[model samples]
Target: MDDNLIFAVIGAGNTGQAMAGYLKLKGFAVRLYDRSEWRFKSLRKHSMRLSDEIVSSQKIDLLTTNLNEAVHGANFIIVSTSTTAHIEIAKRLSEILTNDQTILLHPGRTGGALIFKKILRENRPDLKITIGEFESSIFTTRVSATGSTVHYYGIKNGVHFSTLPAVDVRKIFQILKIYFLKLRPIRMCSTLL
Candidate 1:
């Protein structure tokens, strides 16, 4: 990943923490966001410890409950929330997203990218962005009780994913693959959905 590439993980659950921690450890500037600030209270001094598959302790660049603040200037945004929350998040993002920003839903479930793009287009027709989703989460991880530690059971290999328009898959995958090496692009995303 380029040092200039900024990443934001929007969800403070297990996968979100692991991804944020892992990215921070890898030297990418990472901003972590959640709807609730209470979720971040357990993180010791804003630092997270990642163990198991990968081991590292690093301080995330930013932690905020403000969605706009979390994604401000972020080149890539990772929506790690539940599939059920996709529509709401998409509505919220329609208000905040800027042109050319890329969004990737971690394990978009089935038609996730399409649903998200539809919401974006419906809400903000002028917005120019790429939406994509993983068929499944890339991380098989869990967070410790204190919230200060993340146990990464494994990083999935050859994870399949696709973008809403399909054509942007290769371009987006090029940057994403630097962080998640096993990412594979599928030609037809709806077929999997």
Candidate 2:
């Protein structure tokens, strides 16, 4: 796992779309996926409408409805769906994820990482995976009025994250810093102080 470039932006909503565009612009190979392939059709139409040309899916590596195909060989898997879908996605990912791959539950509001851990463990107890989470998504973006674009409202002032058990906090911080300008490191104890 390179852990530096290839990324899986699961759930191709506004955040996922924006992440796909932004990360691609930053030179990372990005794969976009949703349970429904129709979700990507709108992105193509919107890109064509805004650019007034053929929207080449080639701009990104692959966009598919297949979870296995989307997440294959990905170093970093960022789940961008609503929290309500966590368990289902967890179950799906458990069948595919490799231990070398790290799964980040962006905006892991309450027990998101653990929820995923439990579900994943149920499927494969022998698999040990690294997990990370941020209190919120690093990006603040939305779909345009015409639905042809993702309007990025700039990154938040500060984005802090933690890796469970704290062994790889530094590495997680290092990786996130490349994509998030406002990336901040937080001490788990400091959160309680």
Candidate 3:
């Protein structure tokens, strides 16, 4: 129910649509982005219909293939793309991301945050941003073959998340709790080689 937070979902797959629709359902402004325009051909008027556990038709604020347009002014950049795309996306994001923007990987898979953080540093060392990742996606969702509908499965509980610097966990957690009540903060160990 946060009225001020604007989210940019970076992907148009099942999870991305679910996250965007769910966030919009909760009364937040959301923009959906994808690299492929073909994926969006079936969507009508930039609206997504969610079925199953949660049912709602949400109109995304913006839908585009332009990464810069999607990232601009977004408070939270939610990366729902495949793990394999993380590196390249991180590289592109480093070019346009501004200070104080937070990036959250829906499911980092393995060492996703670390790799992304490293790439951002290498690409834009002075960029100040908080980057974090979940052990897995929060929602279990599936998009229909036509790409117009998303089957909303129940949210998974006990999802662990942590930020790169580990200093802003409390602040980020406060904002996240409104959306995900069951999220847990885990300390990212820097010493682990």
The lDDT leader among the candidates is 3
Per-candidate TM-scores read 0.94, 0.85, 0.95
Off by over 4 Å in 2: 1-4, 45-58, 187-193
Tens digits of lDDT, candidate 1, 111-166: 77888878988889998898888988889999988787899999899999888677
Off by over 4 Å in 1: 44-46, 189-193
Clashes of each: 0, 1, 0
What's the lDDT for all of these models?
Answer: 0.86, 0.74, 0.88
Ranking by TM-score: 3, 1, 2
Q: Number of the top candidate by TM-score?
A: 3
RMSD of 1: 1.9
Give the clashing pairs for model 3. none
Q: How would you encode candidate 2's per-residue C-alpha lDDT over 1-193 as one tens digit per residue? A: 2435788989888777766777776678889888886777766543412121212233667888899998988988888899999999999999999877888877775778778878877899888777777778777777655556666666677877877546777887887786677777764543421
Report the C-alpha lDDT of model 3 over 63-167, residue by residue, as the tens digit: 899999999999999999999999899999999999999999998858888888899989899989999888998999999988888897788999999887887
